[model samples]
Structure formats: structure tokens, C-alpha cells
Target: MANFASTADLEEKKITFEEIAENVYAYTAEGDPNSGVIVGDDGVLVMDAQATPIQAQKLIDCIRGVTDKPIKYVVLSHYHAVRVMGASAYGAEAIIASQLTYDNVVERGQQDFDSEVGRFPRLFDQVETVPGLTWPTITFEKKMSLWMGKREVQLLHLGRSHTKGDIVAWIPDCKVCFAGDMVEYGATPYTGDAYLSDWPTTLDNLMALGAEKMIPGRGEALKTADEVKAGVGGTRDFLSDLFETVKKCVADGKDLTATYKETMDIMRPKYGQWVIFDHCMPFDVTRAYQEASGQEHPQIWTADRDREMWLALERDQSAA
Candidate 1:
């Protein structure tokens, strides 16, 4: 059977730290989850902490290289364990997240932490360094603004796409946006906890921001408007096509196994080149199938569920 979810993905990715604007930066790897840095006059605000303390410290090193300012706030783009588990390492005054994200942390934080660690062991190096669950010191319903001296960073929850509480940090003056998992450059969207029907409209809200530069959740930074559009458009197209195909299969009364195989045959040709395509497809199609079959919210994924789903979808079908 295919090595269970990312277990074979052990090679370390090369890290890149690039300046997208005057003081705005993107800390990216080949295809690992990315973090965004906004160095204001007084302090720095980080978007998306890495998977563990050791990983987060690497991003901290990148920030220190450019500026000596204190890291005051760490904003969680969503409540995914891979993105929010490293909040403690920043030593920021306050960790911020949307109300929905906070709720998810309360609801499924430990399950997610356990599930992710089991799936992608390489990303959670020094996993013991993670302290319990990362909680938000401050939470907002829709939007809020944080100021570092004169610079204002607007945090807005655009809509439900990747998760119910996915937010983007928009710097109006610089026209730079730190789009979390809501937009990915060339990485496959992990829709295991996504709202597929609402994703396109959410992308519409993100497009209205008109950010000249953007730091996606993964992949390299988009330094120009055209690149930004392509990043957002690429993500939208992937979700659109995936959901559309899955919905058609469901309407045709295909079983989950049949739908999965059919969807893979179609999507693999187009999205196979994207990072994590194989690792994410089983989970992605399962969630899409659930949503298409009338489930409103995504079922929380546990480590047990991860293995069971992989075996059912990716292993030998006759044996399964």
C-alpha cells in the first residue's frame, strides 16, 4: 500500500525568506507551510506560526536577520495544528485568532494535533516542544485591526473556505496581503476540513483586496499583481474543478470508492504536478464527497480516520 499519508515525505525542504514589500516578508519552503512577517515601526506581527517550536525558531531567526524589533503578535490564519501549534515560541504579547478559529481550537485542537503529527512526522520535529494546545489570547467575530506605532494591520475573516475561520492580514498602505491557506500558489489545497461550496465566493472576497503582493500559505511569494491573481486563481480553479467533479459523481449515484477513483483519474492529470497532490487527494476527495452527499460541516479527522480512509481509497481496491 502507498505509505500512509506523507510518511515517505521525509526530505527537508530548502527554506526561502524574501521581502515582498518594504518591511513585509514571506518565509517559505519548497512546499511546506509558510509564515508571513510584517515589521512595523514598533514591533513585528507574524502570520501563521510553523508546526513546532524548532520550526518556529527558524522563522524567528529570519525575522531577526532583517530587524531587531520585538515580535509582539502572532496571528493564526486558521486553527490547523500545522499552522498554529508553534505560537508559544514567538513569545508574543498576544496570540490572535478569529472567534470561529478559537472555537475550533476548543473543539478539536488535540485531535488535529494528534492527526497531523501522525500523518506528517517530518513537519513536527521536536514535537514534544509543543505546549499543550495553542490558544488565542484575543479573538474577534468578523474583523479587527492592530497597530504597531503608525502602521495599521487589518485582520479580516473573508469567508469560509479552508476553514470556518480563515483570515487574511491586509496591509493597506503597502497593498500586501498575507493570505493563509485560503490561497496557495502551487500547492494542493487540503480540503479535509473545507467548505467547498463557499470557497469560490470566499476567493471573490479575497480578490477584492487588490493586493499587489501576497504571501500564500505555501509555495513562493507572489511579488506582482499578476502573480497574485494567478496564485488565487489557481487555487480557485482547483477547488472548483474538484468539487464540480465530485458533485457530479454523487448525483450519478456513485459510491464513495467509485467516486474517489473517478475523481482521481480526472484530477491527477491536471493537479498531479502540484506539491502534496498524492498526500492530500484521498482526504480531499473524502471531504468533498461528504459535502456533496449533504454533510454541512466537515467531520473532524482523527489519526485512526486518516489511516482507515487511506486504506480504503489508496490501497488495493479488491482487498479493501
Candidate 2:
């Protein structure tokens, strides 16, 4: 029986640094969080820093293998601890994020750190090295355009998907996009902090960008337009299916335990093998139940809340 989420996922995943576009690359490790690398004429831009300095160093080494250019920018897709906590290691000139993300860091960054570290200890290896909440040196309200020499990187918040602060890095030159946790390819979307009703529209905006190739928050790089569309559609389907099921269950006055069972029974066959599906579902359903019953923003998931919810949902799961 699983004791805690992703704690035993200690074995190193096979790392692949693939150049999907001319100067854009993806550093993927099995289904762990991915960081997109854009090597430009003058410097490099890193999207979604790994969980710790130790974790970030691996990507830095990978970057060194290709170019000796300095990393000039570290972009946070959202405020998740696993993605943003490692920003210090890059030693970049600027760390960039949406203003909402910056605000989220101020609000629940510490609680998120505690919650995430407890859930995925393997990813945050050498956790003590994390400097603290990664505050962006540059914060944008809606859109900001950056230049790494001649390459134009557009940071856009089309709408809220995975979280209120979700953003994507769009490179028009290569028609490649670095989609953060907003769109998971084969992996499950952790919508515990998501706006489920608005998520699909947010994904549509991603589609409208017409990115021929894209790197998702997790899973492998999408090398073709077809694969990019697949990622968006897959994420859309997952969110809609989840909300629809949970909404119906809530309207029928089913309790969370029954909701958990029915939703898992429905989702497991398709998404069971995806990374963190079991871990995310309980949280996902809880948030979905809240939203379906009228809560707007998701309630915070602290370490204490995490344990309580786990026991409430999965305490007897091992015996079953």
C-alpha cells in the first residue's frame, strides 16, 4: 500500500534533453516536472525551475552541454513549490512571473512549500537549499514581451486554467510554446488549486496560439502540431469530465466518500497510470466538490489539510 504520494519515487527518471525547435529545448524526466530551455543569441531563458538547487543543477549541467551562454531569465508558470522554489540556482538577471503569481507567492507560498514537500519528497531532494518563496524580479499584469537578443518570448496569461496565475511562454519565431502546468500531456492535471469552469476556455486560448510544437508541464515534448493539439484536447477532456462527474454527484447529494469512489472508478481506467493520478485525484475531487457546491477559489491545501483529506478519502483504500 502506498504510504505517501511520490515519496518512494526516488529512482531517477531517464532524462531527455530534446531540441524540439531550432533553439527551444525540453528537459523531461519520465513524467516529472519539465523545464523548457530557450537558447537565444545572447543568453538563455529557463521555464519552470526544478524543486531545489540540487534539482536545478541537473538542468544547468544540461544547459552547459549545449551552450555557455548565461541564463538570463527564469519564468514561473505558476506558484507551485515544485516548480518555483529552485529559482535561486539559475542566478539569472531576472526571474519573471505574472503579478497574480507574485501575489500567490506572498499568500500561500510557505504553506504550499510545506504541503508539496510532504507530498513529493523525492522531487524536492536537498530541500534545505531552497532559499524561500521565489519572488519574481519582473511581474506583469496580463502580457509581457521579453527579448533574449533577437528571439521574442511573449509571456501571456490568456486566462486561468490550472491556477489563477498560469502563464505560457510563446516564441513566434519557432511557433513553439512552453505551456506550464496549464496543460499536462499524458499526466493528470492537479486542479486542487484550479478554476475548473474557466479551465477549458483557458485551454482554447492556448489552442488559438497556433503553436506547432509545445512543451507541457509534464510528459514528453510535443514535436508536431498534432501532438500539441492532443495535449490541449486531453487536458480539456480531463477537466470537463472531472467537473461533470463531480457536479452530477454533488447535485445528487452524494457525500465526498461516494464521490471519491465513483469518480475514481470512472477515471482510474483511463488515467490511473498517469503520474500522480492517485495522489492528485483525492485533492482534485475535493476541490471539484467544493466548486460544484459553489466555492470559487480553492481552499488552501496545507500539510494538515493534506493529511486530513488523505485519511478522509484514502485511509481505508489500502484495505480495499
Task: Compare the candidates by lDDT and give the number of the best one.
Answer: 1
lDDT of each candidate versus the true structure: 0.92, 0.91
The TM-scores of all predictions, comma-separated, are: 0.98, 0.97
lDDT of 1 by residue, 18-87 (tens): 8878888899999999999999888999999999998999999999999999999999999988998888
- Superposed on all Cα atoms, the candidates' RMSDs to the truth, in angstroms, are 1.2, 1.3
lDDT of 2 by residue, 1-320 (tens): 34566676788899999888887899999899999999989999999999999999999999999999999999999999999888899999999999999888888889999999999988888899987888899999999999878889999998987889999999998899999999888899999999999999888888998999999999999999999999988888889889999999999999888898899999999889888898889999999999999999988889999889887688655446
lDDT of 1 at 37: 93
Window of ten residues with lowest summed lDDT in model 2: 1-10
lDDT of 2: 0.91
Question: Weakest 10 consecutive residues, lDDT, candidate 1?
Answer: 311-320
Per-residue error for 266 in candidate 2, Å, reads 0.6
Model 1 ranges off by over 4 Å: 316-320
